[model samples]
Target: MGHQYGKKGEELVFWNSQKQAVVSNWIDVEDHKFEPPALELISELLTKPRNGLAPDLAVVAKAEAQLAKVLDVYEARLAEFKYLAADNYTIADVLHLPNLQALMETPAKKLIESRARVSAWCSEILARPAWAKVVEMKLKAHA
Candidate 1:
């Protein structure tokens, strides 16, 4: 599946005995095509400085600017629709679950929380019982 659909395939897939694989690749492409740049920017902002050197404030600012632009795009779309693709939940929203969960604990949390609709969407998704079980399992495993 990964070879066939790349990272999007690796993210989420539904397969049945009929050999049909319902994939999220198209939704991923349409919804997240502009995300790599924001991801790269976040990576640059979060990576530690090496060799006892100080973090570059200028570079961090640039990355924040880039991320802000990406967030603006998301905010606009989310204002109109409850989810990325439509009003209903789908693989498109599911694909973002983990990343958004992680970001909630990071410096970039505001990227999601600052937008009203995006924040509401995240709250609704994160409140699901399945996600709560996943978090519980992760905590128990670490303990």
Candidate 2:
């Protein structure tokens, strides 16, 4: 599930932008308004150290704090809509799966599970067959 784009007279544009480009094309939604939150999640939560070395406690704390604030907004939005960016599942929601799964392995999992709406959303997204397949492939690779 990647995208390939190009101008008629030029070469194919592959990996030209970020996840936003791939998601926008795949879902065909005007997701401009959703970019900031996605970026925030990536920067705030996903950027944390995970190099097999124990991370600095302060760094983990800071990231969790930021995650709490972000999840607060999501909790409110989720009260009205089904997913993060919109009521329907979008790349914005898909964008969080990998990192959110990683975060769940840490103490920060409580931040997500404690929120009813956010927890429900996470459960639904993470349970998708696509994600399950990804998980299976990863386990096989590691094995």
Most TM-score-accurate candidate: 2
Q: Tell me which residue pairs clash in candidate 2.
A: none
* Model 2: lowest-lDDT 10 consecutive positions: 4-13
Alpha-carbon local distance difference test for all models: 0.61, 0.63
- Per-candidate TM vs. native? 0.63, 0.65
Tens digit per residue, CA lDDT, model 2, 2-115: 233233422223344663464355333213333343434444454554443444566556656666777787789789888754455655676677766666665567888999
Query: What's the lDDT for candidate 1?
Result: 0.61
lDDT, candidate 1, 84-130, per-residue tens: 65555556666666666655755667776887777888889888786
Residue 13 miss distance in model 1 (angstroms): 9.7
Compared with the true structure, model 2 gives a TM-score of: 0.65
